[model samples]
Target: MDFAFSEEQEMLRSQARSFVTDRFGAERVAQLAETEAGWDESSWDAMTELGWMGLSIPEEQGGAGFGFLEEAVLFEELGYGLYPGPYFSTVALARRALDGAPEQLKRLASGGSRLTLAWIEGGRAKLLPETGMSTQAQESGDGWTLTGEKHLVPDASAATDVVVVAAGPEGLGLWVARCEDAKIEMDPTMDRTRRLGRIIFDGTPAEQVAGAGDVRSTLERVQMTAYAALALEAVGAGQAAFELAADHVKTREQFGKPIGAYQAVSHQVVDSYIGIELARSLAYWAAWCVAEGDERAPMAAAAAKSFAGEAAVASCERAIQVHGGIGFTYEHPLHRYYKRAQWIDSFDGFGSVQRASVATALLGS
Candidate 1:
């Protein structure tokens, strides 16, 4: 089978790249990163106008009617441009939680509401709910009341609603809580481009979206998708760093000669290229698996995320090294990419967790 993106997918990629490049310039992104919201509303509005917010939703639900592949393509571009916002949290995480809620899905697809996933508890990254979840969802008369603290919730401050994963009397359940009901505190992050917050739910009323029986499946699906998306983002960031380093070495001169002419510099560039290519291949393969609902999606996603995350960090490090002192400075954009790569690498789970997932899939757990 041909392992290339279709013409339509390529077009979507091109469109997304152009939109990010034009809309989120480096200076503009930097400015937004320093703001309290950590993102520009105007840019988000522009994206909504472009129908990107609804890219993966069904056409019947007021969406663009695209599949996971299209969504991956867009995210790859967003990663390359380092577009800062809650788009990933809203579209990738919360939107998936609205699987059975048609009204919420329609509103999200129409960009009429913004929601984020508040699943991480105690600042620990976990793939399963059986891990260290302290949040509890107590059954009330007709609703549920959640009481617990969630740490490192992505874009919590910007969300109108939060989909929280909590342990109930019956087991794990997915609960939707209004942002107004929870106390949100912005957390300082290394990558200011991406916002994170701590949400405290003190007797917060919530609506149950999925129960214990179905929550695992939903969480697994969300986790796999998140891995795939993050892998693609790593690929994008790695590719960008490789290009930046390659361009810098070609122009920057040392000892009256271009640094790229030196074997040491050339070798690093080649290494970055190789790593990026490998990560890109894996990321695309995982994306295709997810889009097709293939059985190998979980394994592919784990492998892709592991390799891509490392590749991105390596590429950024090499990029900074190639640029010498200028790269480490705040004035240079290379540091921004490095910070973003580091943040993405730690998202969902680290390389160790991903490797464990791969091992578990290969060997019987």
Candidate 2:
């Protein structure tokens, strides 16, 4: 099938690329790595001004009136740039949940408000929540109280609203918590580019959005979005990493000849290039599924995440080796991409998770 973008989509992609390139380019990611926070709020505002922050929201609520395809196109650009921000948190993934909340969605799209969802604890969920939760309707004369702690809340530090998940007496569900009424505390995290912290709740308040039946459905969709977004990022990182490797091999000489001329290094560069293209293909297929509402999107998403994650990490490692000692240095740009690649690959699903997901899809059990 032809994967070429629609004319409007291509225009959207071109506009987003120019905007991001001009606003948050490579140097910007390096600068953010120095600071404790991930996003350049001004750049984010620029995205909002470009209507990118509202890419998937309904135009009726002051948004761009687009959906997954638009998001995927923009994400490919984000990956290419290795943008160090919470675009995934605020826009691509959580916006769907916010779409359920009219007021919050409108505020987020039009008012420069930020929204994030806290589902997995520590990082991506390899399993389920430990010491999960059970809901109780505490009888207050006026209302009730909710108490639960969600660890490793992403981009919650500066967020205007957080969508929190909890297991109630009936089943697993989620609710929205405002930082003001709900006890939220943030701190610096390993991935300084993405804001993460632990959220505390002491009779902390919430606004329920989904119940048992649809909660997991919604959550799964969000996870797919996360996988899709991060996978695209890996594609970007992988492409950059491979380029770095190839460029070094072509120029870096040893024994009076370019290292790329040697069979060993030449083969390595070739391998990296192949992996990047194959993973890119899978990722784009997943994006297409998401945009078209294909059922295969979920499994295809898992496959894409698996492939991209593996590729990003492997490509970075190989690229580092291609750069020799320089690649290991703090000053080298390779290290920046390397670290980011490592961190992002570890998100959504690790190697094994994706493998099993692929297996589950391929085998009829």
Candidate 3:
């Protein structure tokens, strides 16, 4: 399949790049990362005004009716800009969790309200339902009550609603509950730009979203989507790091000569370029599979995430190395990219986990 972006997709990328450059420049992003909210509401409002909040929602649901490819285009630019916020949680995870719930979907897509997924338990990230057995849902009066603690929930404090993955008497299920019903506490995070929260749901009222049937399959699909988005986000970070390194090497003089002229620095920069290109190819392919609903999407997503995660982290490290001592300082933005790359590499599933997923898909488990 042709992985090249279409004209419209290119236009979308151009627009996103321009918007991020104008609205979420480096200084603004840095300021927001230090703020209590960790995100700019006006920037989010502008994105909503541009219809980006519902970029992937179906047309029938009051969205732009675009596919995952378009969504990937937007996320890639967002990552490049380091536009901190709940875009990943709201659009990638929460929207998919509320797939059948049109009313809630519309409200979330409208952009004022935010939603996040609470899947991790006891600070462990488990993608399979069998492993997510800590959180439990019990039948209550006219509804279900969730009683458990979820840790490392992304953007949980800013979320108006949370889709909780829990185990019940029958089987694995998904439940939606208001964030206000649970105790949300901010957690320490490696990447300060992204907020992580711990949530305790003590008999919190919830409405079942998925019950019976193969709920694990649904969870896998959600994971696949998230993996693809994260892969593209990693690719974006890699691109940014690569550019930063390349520009620095060209200008920074060592022994009265540009460092880029040195074979050692030049070779590392070339490796970063090659890594970014390879990861970008796989990420775009995975995005296409997701957009077209291809059967190999799960495997493709795994491959993309694994490779892109490694590549992005490597590229950021190379950037730091190329920049020399200044790169390690907090005053430099390259460290922020490196930290964000590490954060993205660890989210949903890490490099080893994703590679294991690919192995499972290839060989019968």
Q: Mark the regions of model 1 whose C-alpha exceeds 4 Å error after superposition.
A: none
Q: What ranking of all candidate models by TM-score puts the best one first?
A: 1, 3, 2
Runs in model 3 deviating more than 4 A are none
| Candidate 3 clashes between residue pairs 3 or more apart in a chain or in different chains | none
Q: In angstroms, what RMSD does candidate 3 have relative to the true structure?
A: 1.5
Query: Residue by residue across 112-131, what tens digits does model 1's lDDT show?
Result: 77888988876556756665
User: What local lDDT does model 3 show for residue 242?
Assistant: 95
Give candidate 2 regions above 4 Å deviation: 121-145, 180-190
What would the TM-score be for candidate 2 when compared with the true structure? Answer: 0.90
37-110 per-residue lDDT for model 2 (tens digits): 55676766777787887777788888787888888888877877777667777776567666567777787777
How does residue 161 of candidate 3 score in lDDT?
87
Sort by lDDT, best first: what order? 1, 3, 2
What are the clash counts of all predictions, listed in order? 0, 2, 0
lDDT of each: 0.87, 0.74, 0.87
lDDT of 1: 0.87
